[model samples]
Target: MARVIALVIVLPVRLVWDALGYCLKQLWRWVLAPIGRALGWLIHHLIVIPLRFLWEWVFVPVGRALWWVIDLLVVTPLKWLWGWVLFPVLKALWWVVDLLVVTPLGWLWRYVLAPVGRAVGAALAWAWDVAGRISRAVGRALGWVLWNLIGRPLAWTYRVILTPVGHWLRTWVWAPVASVARAVRAAAREVRVALFGGPR
Candidate 1:
């Protein structure tokens, strides 16, 4: 009876557990693992390997060839032309400019312009000196004429007429007026003292 009960309980439990474990194993093998492997293969072959090949062979070589062509066709020719043609032409132009323009200007400045400037400056200085002498002579003549005509007459008049008149007025008229003012002030002081009975 005990063996029959144990078999009835344990057998069903073991069977259920085994069924679940087998299902899990089958699901992993058929679904998850295959998906992971497919993804890895796709990435390696399509994206990574192709990019590596393109970089190593196609892109690098093409870039190098393009640079080589640019140097051969453009840079080398431009450098050669500049060295052979443009450099010589520019040097010749500089020589011509120095000969035609610069040398002539230097000669003109040395021979023609310098002498003319010196002559002009000397003439101006001479004229200025003559003008200054003439001006001084004129000023002296005017001063002498003014002294004789106006200043001397005014001085004579002041000495002869004004001095005596001013002295006479000061002696007669001013002295009398000052004496009368002093007398009037003395009388006012006496009247104030008698009325107010104090100095003020």
Candidate 2:
């Protein structure tokens, strides 16, 4: 009795629940799925494709044109300033510096300082040679005067007069002194032997 009653109660509820699940599944598969696919296709074609095309074609070309305008107006003028105006001005300044400062200094060094220095050196060398010659001549004159005046007289006195005088003194005075000394020594020996013994 209880089993029949439970079946009668649960059977309609389970059938209704199954039917609702089938309807929901079919709606999702047929209606909602196709609508979602269509929405995706429309968003891709209308919004995404148009935006990509606009970015590639319109916006990119406009940006390139703006860049070209800036390059032409601003950058080209700056290039011309450096190339045509400022570069030539700097070159002219370098030329002026070379002309006024460098050229004169080079000329002064090459012409004035070099020649003057060479002339001064030559004059000094010539003066040195003349002074050396004068000194040599004075020395020769002094040597000639000394040899004739003092050295010749001294040589003559030593050779002729002093040599004979020294020989005469040695023969006369030295011989007598040596003889007297020998005689005295012999007499003293004889007296010493007479006072002491003959041999000890």
Candidate 3:
């Protein structure tokens, strides 16, 4: 019974809330429609119409007239004047370019190359001298070490380690292979002489 009562109360409240929402929406549209119409009228009559007129009547013809006058008065005269007055000016400019840009660049090359070449030459000479000194020192040190400390011991070590291996290979592997190769060669020569009527 309590649940049924609660449901009945909630249903009427929902109905009232929906009716209020619909009424508020209708009222808002009714109020804003006139304001929107007025704003449209204001923009069309005041802003857009004047802007269109200014663009069509003032901006286009004035810009065209200005361009025509500039072409006739300024650009055409300057073009002609360029031939008359600009020749000497261009010659002067060329001379200036030769003096300022080319000559200075030539001088810069001489100035820079001489000093830089000299410095590089000096540096290379110094480097070569230092390298020679270092090489001599290292060579002397290595020679002394080999003569005094390592040469005899290294020779003894080589003899002890390698002599037996060398002897064994010379006796076993080298001797047998050499003998077999010689025998094969002799038989090949005999067969060739028998077939080809004596050796060449």
Cα-based RMSD of the predictions, in order? 17.3, 27.1, 22.6
Number of the top candidate by lDDT? 1
| Segments in model 3 whose C-alpha atoms lie over 4 Å from true places | 2-5, 77-88, 95-127, 130-200
Candidate 2's TM-score reads 0.41
Query: Where does candidate 3 clash, by residue pair?
Result: none
Off by over 4 Å in 2: 1-103, 178-200
Worst 10 residues of 3 by lDDT: 191-200
N/CA/C clash count, model 3? 0
lDDT of 3 by residue, 104-135 (tens): 98998899988899999999999999999999
Per-residue lDDT of 78 in model 1: 99
By lDDT, highest first, what's the ranking? Answer: 1, 2, 3
True-structure lDDT of candidate 2: 0.96
In model 2, what are the clashing residue pairs, if there are any? none
TM match of model 3 to true structure? 0.44
lDDT of 2 at 190: 89
